[model samples]
Target chain A: MSMTHWQAAFAARIARDEPQWLAPMRAAAMTSFNALGFPTTALEDWNYTSLSSIAEVPFTVGASASSTTVADLTPYMINAEWPTIVLLNGSYSPSLSSLDSIPAGMLVMDLAQATREQPALMQQHFGTVATSEHAMTSMNTGLMQDGVFVHVPKHVESETPIHILHVSDAAAAMSAKFPRTLIVAEAFAKATVLESFVGMADVAYFTNHVAEVVVGEHATITHTKIQRESDLATHVSTTEVHQARNSHYVNFSMAMGSKLSRTNVYTVLDGDGGGVTLNGLYLGKGTQHTDHQTRIEHAQPNCFSRELYKGVLDDASHAVFNGKVYVHPIAQKTDGKQSNHTLLLSPDARIDTKPQLEIFADDVRCTHGATVGRMDEAGLFYMKSRGVPAETARRLLTYAFAADVLETIENETVKQALEQLTLERYAGSGNNTAHAAREH
Target chain B: MLEISNLTATAGEKDILKGINLTVNAGEVHAIMGPNGSGKSTLAQVLAGHPSYEVTGGTVHFEGEDLLELEPEERAHKGVFLAFQYPIEIPGVSNAYFLRSAYNAMRVARGGEEVDPMEFLDVMEEKLKIVEMDDAMLARSVNMGFSGGEKKRNEILQMAVLEPKLAILDETDSGLDIDALRVVAEGVNKLRRPDNAAIVVTHYQRLLNYIIPDFVHVLAGGRIIRSGGKELALELEEKGYDWLLQEALA
Candidate 1:
């Protein structure tokens, strides 16, 4: 479909129900989306990823929330008691959400309802950080109807994490869903936000998600996203963050499923003494293509940033990782480190990794490295010499290749769950496997 | 218990072992001492299947089974072990996990039930004592960040657990101090049985003072040039390999 077709379809189908305050922003977003169009290989930022497959499909927009019971969500829930927000097909489902236990000062509700109740908050942050400068994010901003809106008040220190579960149960093929999420943590507050994008059925669809995070001064926040979409789906998500002074933010992204998936995370340390860590692990098999593009901007002095992204590719799958760390001229005393490592399991698997560092500061410590290689043969032989079968040895090493990233997760329950998922994905099935042999 | 007939192997285009012949019987410790470039480590690695060396011509029989026809792990299951000179470091896999996996694999190969962590821990505790190592080593990644002595001791600990019938020690004493060498030698000694044999390949005879070998052979230019009893090692230690090389040429 062409850009005009998308704009015309959006106006005909979605313009009737929006409030008057959002109409101008939506129109401006539509104009931006039209100007940017869909990113192609011509763009440097998207050199390795192609959107032809997605652009060829005439995906119908405005898919309604699918009807699902609490039982359907059993397999995806990390914890049963944590406050949950469910977004089915692009729209929020109140019946499936359980926010009754949320703290008194915390606000967790659907984005559309939050827009009505907290219009000032929505207008202030909705499209501010994740502006309409990019194509997919711009399109999402133009068409987004419902998503998640979370606000943790000053000094709230929410112990229980908020889970945003995005489920795509498309009634028909070629369905498209646009879900947005806005998280705001006030000063001295602490919170963890987990977003899971899961496709219930094996059907062709498209999911364009946009999330914006605001970490106040002296606050700490952890944001994790686990994407397990359908093998036939196309998933593109962008997360933009702004950090205040002395704030700490950690973002963990794991991409396990989808035919074509592109994940972009852009974080700017806008205040002095702030720190940020972006860690990601992507597993690809079959003909899947997983791409991760991250950019961290040190806009202030004395900021610290660390990033480690690793990919495990098997079969004929392909993975791409491009990490860029920019230190502005005024951002002196910056300490930044970035690394991208890939492990190719099969001979046919391929990975393209690049670590781009741009430092304009005269006094700064910055380092970046990228490595693309196969499993260690010497290590394999050592294991085999100890009586481990070749197949089992390979699995163990592959699992170990991805285990270090899981070690950086602070949430114990989520870390264990993600570890188990990683082990199962790479280790396959066997008696006395790594999962069974785990110590504590 | 083990026999090698006319064994010839090459690493890449360079021949490392040429027309070597040896036999090891049960209850015997044979020491193959040689100078540098004498294929001592190559011979040991070939016996345990290092995969880097290509055996062009050889017939190795371990207890009447074709040892060369099996994979490394199969050879391991058939009671063959190689204590590496430079043990490879495997990160992210705990030492206890690797030990239990190897132990269970050997057990299952022998048609025995696998042991649980509790039972495995008990067995590990005993083996750690054999090597004079503490239990702290078991929680670390396999051989990762271990000192030289710690790595060698970990190898000996594995030897104690696997209990292979034919253990090949490839320069196992090269990087050990006096205390570590004695502990390693004692570990090997305690694991010895009348039904098992060992091939200790070394350049120096310092290690033979602790673990005495029944037979000592001098390997030069990929061939065993001389053979004698335990006293031959002491003579080589005193006289060096030059006199033996001249005698072999004459």
Candidate 2:
């Protein structure tokens, strides 16, 4: 069984002399993961995605790396603007990382170091934000190896973004990485964290990552995740967030690579006058399958939430988006809006979208919808009739579709990089790009 | 020069245009006035190579080459333009960008150099003034959130940029007020030259008053039943289309 394979593998790792406070938590997570097992289509949340393919592949935790150099990773770096923390095959790579001028009262180190140095702080916030309800989150909790932990003290806004790069070093054998991240922002603090995943193409690997974020009162946080794993890899990521009073939180998850990927994000506005925005962009091509599931919970009054997820699907690819906005009965004057838009570029592409809104408060306002539309034929013809070629017209419309979501990004450095990546995706897709218009 | 002989086209198993014959020389404007369902717009779209219409029997020779054999953009590159009856709204693409791309494409299609955005802005500013449009309009998405008058004016702006040899204005006066109609018509008049021609298709003589046509023809039953001088539009304007339809039947 899949449960026995993971349990026996992780038993050896945790058997090492670790912190007593963390040992029981991992054991309980293992128990829950074993009981829940892997989700199937019979379950409502897992209806559109199947794990049979991932279940068949043999996955090992924290496998050793295979000669990955810094030069090989330069293509994935964000270039001089920010400090980077590098992880190679789920292990901290200090030789590849560059961290300078770290602020006081802030911690930017591996989870192992935090467990040893700041055990009390780790005990207070590590497992508090994440729950082991989902099987995959439980799996990450039980077997997660070395990952980064970031903590910002009150009113110490980060001047630049902090980059976290996760690189998979797999050769021949199917390696697995259970990366765990815990971030905490004190009251009135502001920070932006960029999590980027990069790996080799056609390498069979598994990356199950879980990130837990907590924002104190009046704090603001911008958490961005860029998942560019190998096309032959299986990526399942879950992010859980909780915000305090008068806080603001934003989650931007862009998935452009992987054979099968699923991103599950859950946010709760626990404090009055708090706001949250959940934004995502997915580009699915070939036989890739991408799924996004988001849930926003407004538990307090006068809170606001906006969620927008857009997907572009081509070839025989499939995309699924399920967004839910829930307002509690006592949460009066709450405002929430959710929208999902998908553009189908080929006849074989398929999309399934569902926007669910549950509002129990009579004074609250909530609206949600989903749209699956093809490229505008009349618009394309109009552009073509103006002398723009049909092929360039198609690319223009597709680029416009992606830019709609990218333009809303708040960070300039990240936004420009995303725009460049989107253009590269388009140029790479048109195998006959020799005919593409390069006249300026 | 443009010439069409016995052109017949169908839209989804029904003939929208049947046996349409017309010709326009350089520096000439031929106005085709027809009643509703008389296939006026179909003729315009067919000439511009719209794929929705199937040309079953037709031979359109634009400057002595078969125009129907080319794609829509190819036809546009060959100096065939259609000012749409309803300009489509394309969100997320600015008006100036769309215009520059179209203009550069037309240039490159005929073996000319493509202009950069900064270089094309000079040309665009001149044309925008003709349509009395603001620079803000050029920055917004094409036709998105634009009023009817603004959309019509944008069509003229594109025309002034491309400077097509054979321009087909399809019902350009449908949704415009008088002031906007004046702006659009004046822009067309300014773009007219000795080497280019235009076909003004409308249902009323009001537009004809601004842009005087050299030849006015009445279309009925999918054919040009009557062809006369510009005075024909004034006569039809005063009497409506009933007498013309009855005369065609007789």
Candidate 3:
């Protein structure tokens, strides 16, 4: 697991005349990645998720290839009309992506290209928010080849959302892919971006991803990450957000796939009147495992944050939610609320939820709560008394439980689409026709 | 259409209904007036097959079949409806959805096809007007944020839509205003048919004014101590249950 061997080899293989500042940052990150191996259950954050399944993955860094075609990558694209960036095996696939209609003065390109073409701009903001501290993050920073870099200048807004799709088409049993995304919204600017991680094959691969979002004063940003990898793939991603004075930031993460997936979302309200809202929904079935570890820090006065996460566990699948909110000494008038609720359909399925709040300021108002239970018996009885079969009753109740979270999405079309997908996911659980008939 | 024989039931270690015997023919409305904890609700719950109460010795025949042998849902499917006194609040379930499910459940139990949403909505639109309830309540969650009067009216709406053979109103007039009470009573009176019956359980005679009863019975302790025509309700309202309890004891 030493980095000395791979650092020299990676440097020799990459093209010459690359940005000078990136090499040392990558070298230092590789050192940190080597020092800290994969986290284990002994750590409180990783207690419920078992990383031993991915410990022995035979992973090797992949090289860029030009033969990748858009037809091969069409299944993973969510929005075809928006400016698109496609990354294959952690390398930019120029032939498969298009960015024709981007507004003027907005910078949207591969981070690797941004580093080579505009070194000064890349040096000012790259790695500014996501530090190389944890092993997965450090590995992403160390071995990162190509990702998205989006910059919206002051007072500018984009009409359409930027779409970035990351596909892992690796053939090796233990191949590794590292993807990084860096976005900066200047003062009074607005933008929406969606990042999707998908796997084209069912091979056992590992994807380590890191994204950094910085919102300036009076700015607003909405970012969404959708993870739908292969059944045998392991995904670990961290999204760090820093909100400045009077700025608003919203991040949504949906985990529907991956054998062992964990997402860490960290938000910091760094200035006065700043607000951030974090929302997530994870649907796990079969033997899949999903974990969401979220932390929100209120560092200044008049800041607010709300976190709502929900999960539905079926079969023998397991879900974990560890959400923490911190109110610092000067962060008064901070209205923070966190709630995590889960439904365990099968007796064997499990969910571990903990909502933590630490407040040092006496003038702040913060609340946190968590609930884990089966379908409401009274509710089921009431529905059954009406003529709904027991199975349909269960499905309706389950969908309603998740709908409480889906209704929070601000976009009408996205909210409706996600709600339909949520219902379909429940309907796919061996009660399709019954649920479909009930819906009508 | 309904018969009870030796109906003995208990909640925990205390007996609530002791060997209660009564019978109701079709097209009759019977009123049961009792003091607090005199087993008025116990009779309604036991008849509805609530799992909390244990039936030590009882036999209920509804439409010539053993009613106590069936589950609560089965009892409901067999045309036995209990309008709760304190209706349970079900969050996240729409009122329309709840009523449609109940209506379809009863229909399917009788070997009929289930109604589609559009047809069910048409039926709800017609029945909701009977209770003077707005269409908004039907779209909202069942009893989640409804006022007391709204909840009771919603119950009557369910009764109108389901049209059960035996409708048991267990203290449905407790928290209703005068207008809500009149609307609910009118809804119930409209649903009455020669082939259906009702058992109105209450502690006062106020509700009987809106929907006149054919018979009134005084339930003291666990058994009916007196039975008379509708005038008994007016008499009880004038003298109260204490005088009747004293008369029964004497």
Candidate 4:
């Protein structure tokens, strides 16, 4: 029989001598990944996105990438005082990172080190939070060579945010990179992680990323992910979170550049009185397509979740947002809300939004809605009649649409970075409607 | 310094204003009073170059220049202001930002220096006092969630800030209480200069009590039926608009 596409990639990995126990788990994960394959449009969960373009290319599995420095990551790096873990082509880079300032009682190391040093801990919690329902998660478990792992002990709080940066240096075109991150916070511990994924502007690559978080009782975790890959690159990222009793979880994500990118966030509130907040912003221009999908599961009583996602599309770009919230029967006092808003700046730009709410419990308060709007003509006229120039009005209105959601971000530095990037996007697309009107 | 000769306009092929003639020099406030459906607001809208109103026949001249040829914003840059009856609400744009943008845009068109935010805030605070507005209103979105009186006062505040040559108020007193009417009329009276003129369009004569008009013109059935002194508004208030409608029909 002819071997499948993933089989060859798997064969190349087991060729080297690896950890002893990983052999059986890798075998099982490979079997599941081959069965699942790539999700297609026939599946209702991925109806708006198609993987045909991704499935066509023959991808090379990456081991080592070209040499890069901190200079290549300055654009996407936040200006702050924190310990950062830098990864080049999905592998750890000790030279390009700063680990001297990490706080005490925290275990911040690569997966390989965790597997060797804390063998029992790695055996206990490696795949506990990362699910294997789909191919991407299982594929990462089977073939992921090196990734990031962070653990915060009980009753400790770190003020400085731990930054995990993944910079893709595609030494060879058509190479594929798989990045996995696992974070475990014990009871009453608090930590914040800022994770970013970026690459060169014109490079072509495939990035499959997954992050899983295990939040314990009364523990707090704030995870922010920023995906800004090259326009010729493809990115598929998934985030999974499981919260304990009375724990708190906040997730913020922004998708800026990619030919075809999808960001999926799934959360399960397994304990009572826990809270979840999810906020996202996606910007697409040119022929880029950005998708944001979120699912919040309320399995316990007295839990609450809030989700708001907004998108802006210009040129011939497209965007999609599908958010679902499910409240079980035992979760009677659950409170959940989800809102999706999109603004199309061109006639050819489009968006598809599906907001779903599934509640089996009575006496629960849940609200879900989606809205789509083009530029407001009356608002433009009001600005024009007030003597504001046409182009200025257009830029201001466009900025205001995205700024409304960006203002909700609690991190001041992160908010400013995103705002600058958004302004650059608007300035780059100078042929937008307002400019067209001015030309006429 | 404004002239309208044989001015006619239509909306969707239906004539709304037919054969209107008026003249106003500088240093005057002219009140055009009429009953409902008498096309009182249409004249103010047409003069400001609203796109919905097509000028079928006639000419409007401001400072001896054809005003109809200029865009609405161009007319605004040349010192023409219209206080809308119902101001539109724009969310996510702060009141201070919108005001400064308008001020700077006009200044750029006039080849004058633009005011910085600190300097503009000083100017805005002074104008807000003229319109009896609070400082906190400047931080909120433009006209979003504002009460009826606050919106009207905001319009007057804008008019006060722009300091236009010819200001038109369309039914500015319809939804106002006595206090707001007094504040708005006081603000208007303060803006009058020997070089600028005003046009007040109202359905009632009560607003004339605060700011007296130089001339009272009664309009009926798309035409100005009569013109008199300030006593004309008083006479219409004492009686009703029936006399003017009858006189014009005859």
Give the alpha-carbon lDDT of every model. Answer: 0.90, 0.87, 0.82, 0.84
> Tens digits of per-residue lDDT for model 3 on B1-250?
8999989999999998988989999999999999998999999888887767899997999989999898777887888888988776776556776677678767888899888777988898889899999998877878888999999998888888888889999999999889989999999999999999999999989999998999998887899989999999999999888888888889
Candidate 4 stretches greater than 4 Å from native: A1-3, A15-23, A103-105, A170-172, A427-440, B12-14
Docking class of 4: acceptable
Query: Please, what are the lDDT tens digits per residue for candidate 2 over residues A1-440?
Result: 77778888788788787888888988898888888877787889888998878775668776654687878887888665477888887788888887774555677888888888888879999988887389889888888888899998899887578888998755524878889999999999988889998876478888889999999999998999998888888889999998999999999989998898999999889999999999999999999999899988899999999888888999999988989888899889998888889999999999989888889999988888888899988989999999999988988788777767877789877876776677677645543222122112
lDDT string, candidate 1, A1-440, tens digits: 57767887778756476767778877888888888888999999999999987786778876744667899999899897999999887778888888888877989999878878998888878777886378999888887868899998899897678999998775625788889999999999989999999988888899999999999999988999999999999999999999999999899999998999999999989999999999999999999999999999999999999999988999999999999899999999999999888999889999988788999999999998988889999999999999999988998888888987888888888887888888888777555443443462
* Cα displacement (Å) at residue A130, model 3: 0.7
Q: Candidate 3 on A365-437: residue-level lDDT in tens?
A: 8888898889888777656554456776777788777767776777654555566667788645542332232
Candidate 4 local lDDT, B114-176, one digit each (tens) = 877778888887898999889888888789999888999998888988889999999999899
Which 10 consecutive positions of candidate 4 chain B have the poorest summed lDDT?
B88-97
Cα-based TM-score, every candidate? 0.97, 0.95, 0.90, 0.92
| TM-score ranking, best first | 1, 2, 4, 3
DockQ of each: 0.65, 0.51, 0.32, 0.40
Q: What are the interface RMSDs of all the models?
A: 1.6, 4.4, 3.6, 7.7
lDDT of 4 by residue, A1-440 (tens): 11276788888888867667777888888888888777788888889888778775777778455767778767666863578888888788888788888889898888878887878777767777777487777877777777888999999898677889888775736878788888999999999888888876477888888888999999999888888887888899888999999999999888987799988899999999999999988988898889888989999999999998988888999998999898999998999988999999999999999998999999799998889999877777677777787788887778777767777667777767777677667644543322111110
Best by the lDDT measure: 1
In the order shown, the candidates' Cα RMSDs to the true structure are: 1.6, 2.7, 3.5, 3.9
True contacts kept of each: 0.58, 0.60, 0.25, 0.39
* Best candidate, DockQ: 1
